[model samples]
Target: MKDKFEFAHGEASVIQLKDISASGRARLLDMAFARLRFSLFVMPVVSVVFVWYYGKINEDYRVLIWSALYCCAALVTFLILRLYREDQKKQSSEWLLITWLPRIQLVAAFHGLGLMVLLPMVSHTATIEFKYLFTLTLAAIVAGNATHQAPMLSVFNCFLIFSWHCTVLLMPWSFSSHWQFIMPLSVLYGIGMFKHALTSHRFFVRMIWLEEEGSRLAENFKLAKNAAETALSDKNQFLTTASHDLRQPMQAMGFLIESIIRRNIDAGLKRSLDDLKQSVRLATQMFNSLLDLSRIEAGAVDIKLRPVNLNSLIDDIALIFREEAVNRNLDLRTWNRKEKVFVIADETLLRQSITNLMHNALRYTKKGKILIATRVRGSCWEVGVWDTGMGVAIDDKEHIYSPFFRNEHAWRIDSAGHGLGLAVVARSAKFMNATYGFTSSEGRGSHFWLRLPAANSIDFSPQGLAVNNLFEEIKDFSRLTGSCLIIDDDPHVCVAWESLLWSWGVRTKCAPSGALALAVIQAGFQPQVIFCDQRLRSGESGFDVLRSLLHLYPEAHGAMISGEFNSRELEHAESEGYLVLHKPLEPDQLYAILSRWLQLKQN
Candidate 1:
């Protein structure tokens, strides 16, 4: 019983293997059929040529017999082409192996049989010619059919067996001394052709499979790319909206804090308020830095290049950091050749880059001094920040400029540092076409530097500064009085503007939209200065509002303010001759601009 069960199990395994092989061949038949069409077309032409040449040389009735056979073969080949074309339209693989492939094998068999029959008829007068013609015809058929037909090994083997038998039978066995050699060589050639056909078939199948897979992968990649782009666009839009909405409340808080600090309060209360102000300032700085990095990543930061005075720029940086350095008990200093050094660069970007470097230096250094200086290095000026701090290790140096990448020492020193300062500096420096690098020795110090092309001749006339001096030359807002209009969708921002401007002794009115601003102007309230938010409610923009208001009040000086850093809006505002400000606006900066506008109106 055990021996009988083993025999039954072996029979079942053989049957299963046969079924698997049949299914695999069925899957490949469609591709093989397509390749067979090329060989079919070539076979008819070769057949007709051989018949015509044989007929011309012999001038016998055998020409007509062979010509009829060739015609029959041509008709079958034409029918096969037609049938395959029709089958391809349906894309049905069901009947391909059983029906179409057999028909193709029948045509190949007919060609082989026709060649064998033609050989004996021409053997008498056309011995050498028959040998040459038969060999060439056999070679052409083998070469042409092998790649397409070899996928079905049984069909290929059938054709090869018939062709080799025909060639061996045609050899001059009775008289030729080399018949033995010739017969063996012909059999070997047939075996070699079979081997070559198997290789070509496998290569063809592999290449076709790869082509199909590659096409699928390409389609998937396209879909992924589109999805990623859409996500990025949505993220940028969210950032823009969030920045605007968040800054409105922050602007209000800043204005309220400044107004309270300016009041005559108790010394203790004033000190507490000062601390609160510092906290607010720090929050504002971090928020702005985050937004700046976002804008840089979103490709929204525009570079506006102009001649800048290195001395004046360095002086401003020192002034800004002077108090901070004092609080830290660190000396912040600048060094340069006594004369003014000039460079053509985007002043805002250059300043931001240098300032970020300065902030980074201050953040890292504990007790040692920080130096902001410039020196001529060949044809370029190297503006650098040298800090006596715990310098970065070699392992950490490469990643120090990457966003949110901090060394263990840095995290220990200040966990609050977002590690964005150097990243901003790197991006800004790149945007301005400047090369930035750093040299550091662990536990001693680090020197971060930016190399900018130096201007040969100085333009004595100073460039228009983004923000004018407020403390040294405090404008008398009390001496000047004018009506100012504030158009912003955010009520908190409008209230903040009103509170600050009213305290400066200027008459102020606020509107939420372009239509509302137009109504206010139509009511015969013409303001001397107009402050418009870049984005208003109800699908309105500051540009439209400004245009409508300006039509009524042409002499009013217009300024655009926004929390979002959109390069398009900035470019438009700049082109339209509007002063641009980002929020939460600095009290000194706002006062400086307002004082200047009010004084100009009075003048």
Candidate 2:
């Protein structure tokens, strides 16, 4: 049984009073009480008809009195039942006894014997017509009680017994020839209906038990759903906190290393430092990608759809990630780089998607070559990431894009990954309305591709534009002279940021909090750019810090820097036209922003 009602073993052969759960039994009793309301109305009316029809010929005042008395009893029962249903309903749940038998036999006796008394009263001094009237009415009242009140088995049996006693007391031949047949037939009707009431009572109780059971299950399901949501929320919070903690040190290391590598250091030491910096940067990237997957799913990522230079975008990605491939001692090569490709895309989403693909290839590939290439397909251009990594098994192919789901072979290779790389790719591809697919042999390797519609506006060659961009970039970077303010509670972060900005030909001041940043502004320091951390150790918000600093210097271009990739604060800022940047900010990304700000200042 999927769900079995707790039924106690008792003396009764047919559905014992104790043979069900307390709540189940209470539900059955509630139905019995409801049916009593209808019975109260019917019984009074039955008495009225009996008195009106018989009073004309007999002129019996006693019958009228009895009728009045019965009607009054019904009225009183109606009021009591109504009050119980409305006010005492909570108490009634406890009325299901240890055996689930109610203590309402007194009430049942009063109602049933009230109808029973009428039959005997009429049969004694009445004609055959009056006798027929009383007998038929008594039969109807008994049948009605059996049909509705059968769940209360003890009450219904009392009703039948009282009626049977009346029939036996008037056993002699007092009926007309036409009505003589009804006397014996009433006994048989009672027997048949008695058996029916027994069967029906059990079924009625079973149905009530099932209904209560279903309600209990629904409540349980609701609690489980709430618990699951809370757990998922906690998991996300834990990841966010962990990411924030890890990024603080990485940000310091990133800035300090970049600052050191900028000097004329030995080539061998510079190369080693480069490797360490790349490792920290990639670790931060992986965590950000995981957060990115969540943002795409939540519909939080803003799609900046535009005509993007595919060749330029891929080359930039290739440049940033090539160090990882070199560290892995793997051949990382790009093909058709000069095809001068262009496509309609969200650059961030497309870049993240391709980066994840390349990351997966790097993480899994132990030997051979990994190829990042472009192929012109029918009506679309496909970017493919091919590798000689361990491929997905035939069985695991279907769930390859599932978050945190990893196959045995893949887990064996890289257990550190939460298996979110492909998930990010799938979600990004879906959001961009692009088609992505993959092919792999279990032992050999895998090839993943994202196919995007080729842009119609491919008039200018990216190579010429690339040359002009290089010249403009160097000029922008070299002329990067401005006063910048950085607000962060971490001491190392503040010092490192100051070092990196000062090296970029920009005068900088780093504050441990918003108040300090304000103090710096008040001390005659006017900043052109502001970078504030979202969460500070002093519990002050980056937004609050920016507002205060900007109030002092309204012309400053401020942005919130956070380890959280898609935090609600950053999303709100982005939507409101404020700039937001992620933590462990790559030198180029920060320099690019500063370069643009400088160019704007010059213009």
Candidate 3:
């Protein structure tokens, strides 16, 4: 066998040192082999054409021998190529280099000696026109070899040798004594073609290397995308667990504080209790804002749309912030037309958006009254919170809506502010299909507004507004008369629920698990309302516990209380027609549930 393709000269150092992979080498072989197979069939016709052209005029049978030898060479290359293809399927592509490289060199030999050298010796073309015509045919064949054989220089050089053979011997035989003058030009053209093939070979190898590099980069990008998604999922889970743990105690303390403030105590102590209550509410706002931003980033915020009464919503928000506004020596006021304005929006998201605006207004405004106003526009309602204090600078306006972004001026006033309040507002407005913007002058004040689409109350009753908004108002809890079933794993949380419900004249049967709650039912304690906490210590969610109890008491009202804002269980509870209340539990929300039960009982 002949030496390998690497024996060819005029290649770059990288390719000569085996830098071209086995697959790259195989691709080159595939292209060359395809051309060889096609040429084998065409060469027989070429031999026929050669014998037909010269044999009629010249009385030479030697031409037939040359044609026979050329056809034989084609036939031998065809048989070996077919055998190579059959075995190539079962073997690695590297076999093309180890086994087929030597065969390709032999294929070149057939074109050189078997066809080129024998052409001039046997076929005597007396006419100069036909002699040049034969030379043109050989030159065309030389050009075709450059296309297929350029991948391997060893094979390319072998095929290229024929052009020199024509220049040195065949052309001279055809031209007679006139050959010496034309010989130099033919040799120069032959040398140019040889150099061109070397460049083409380098280009082919460079393309193969790039293909391998691109494939590796694509795989790495895919792995990185998967890893980022997994890390985001893990972060969401950790936040959910930690939020629930911290909210359990916060919920219990809120209940205990509300229970204390309800009793007849000294005026001085009652004022102190009210102050502490305002402090808790402020802390709850900050915690909820941060958690909300995290949930939105994790793609866990699923906004639910519904009809919301702007009048009732504004009233509730005014009540929540009024206490803090008083402590800050600022007048907190709300104004709207006596008419009950309705809007199509997600009540939860709308409430948060407005609350963030209100909280932001309160944080910046140290003096002057804060006004929460609602206005009717064409096809929409605009609710705005106007405050008078240190207003935003012109440059800070653009980035104010971004999460955790605070300017130097505002940071000095409220060092504890996380800047998430306005960010939550922006996201909540987008999710609810509402729009919000602000107008502010530095050191004067800011007026932030949220606009929502006007919705007709014909689809839903106007009187049912209070029934829908669980956080509306803290009415006379003495009116709440119903038996409550509380399911929670934390002992402090259960006690807080019991004390708060008892104060509201709600008879309660508390249990730590679903099985124990069933035991209470077995003992003949029927409940009118069931309040279950999500993420129980028994590995059963509030939805799982309430599912069994709700089936047993179809007519009874049931609700889920949990601090997790983004959870499948929270979504599942709401889907099953149960009201899902997030912690720390609001006194007004529980009262809303109990009030509905009392109405049902009385009817």
Index of the highest-lDDT prediction: 3
lDDT of 2 by residue, 1-603 (tens): 012223443542344455566766666666665565577667667777777877787877767887788778777877776656664445545654432334345556666667666655666567777777677777776777677777756666765676654563454544535445665787688887787767667668767655766887898998998888777666666666666777788778878877776653698896787777666656655555576545554455557555666776566578777888888899998886555677767766887899889989998999888999998999888999999988889899999999988888877888889988899899888878899999998778999999998877642222111111112112223546788988888888888888888777788988888888878888999889988888888898787777777777777787778777656776676666667666667765677677766643342
Model 1 misplaced stretches (Cα beyond 4 Å): 1-68, 78-102, 112-144, 151-158, 161-195, 238-243, 263-301, 306-344, 347-372, 376-381, 385-448, 453-485, 498-530, 538-558, 564-576, 599-603
Alpha-carbon shift of residue 429 in model 3 (angstroms):
8.0
Q: Which 10 residues in a row give candidate 2 its minimum summed lDDT?
A: 464-473
Weakest lDDT window of 10 consecutive positions for candidate 1: 1-10
lDDT of 3: 0.75
TM-score of each: 0.60, 0.59, 0.66
Model 1 backbone overlap count: 0
Error of 3 at 109 (Å): 3.2
Off by over 4 Å in 3: 1-21, 119-131, 162-180, 206-214, 228-250, 253-303, 309-342, 348-374, 382-451, 455-470, 473-485, 495-509, 514-529, 539-558, 562-579, 595-603
Candidate 1 lDDT over 1-603, as tens digits, reads 000111132253212212323335554565554555555556557666766777667777775677666667667777877877787566555555667667766655665666566656666656565556677677767766676676555556556656656667666742155567677777777778877776765554444444555776899999998898788777877887788887888778877777676653688897788778766755665576566656666777556555677777777678778899999999888898787787767766787788889888898899889999999888989999999998989999889899999988888998878988898788878878889999999998899999998877643221233432212223243434889999988877778777777766678899998888878888988898898888777788787777778777788877778787665866677776667777877666677677666773444
RMSD of each: 9.8, 9.1, 8.5
Best by TM-score: 3
Go through the candidates in order and give each one's C-alpha lDDT. Answer: 0.71, 0.71, 0.75
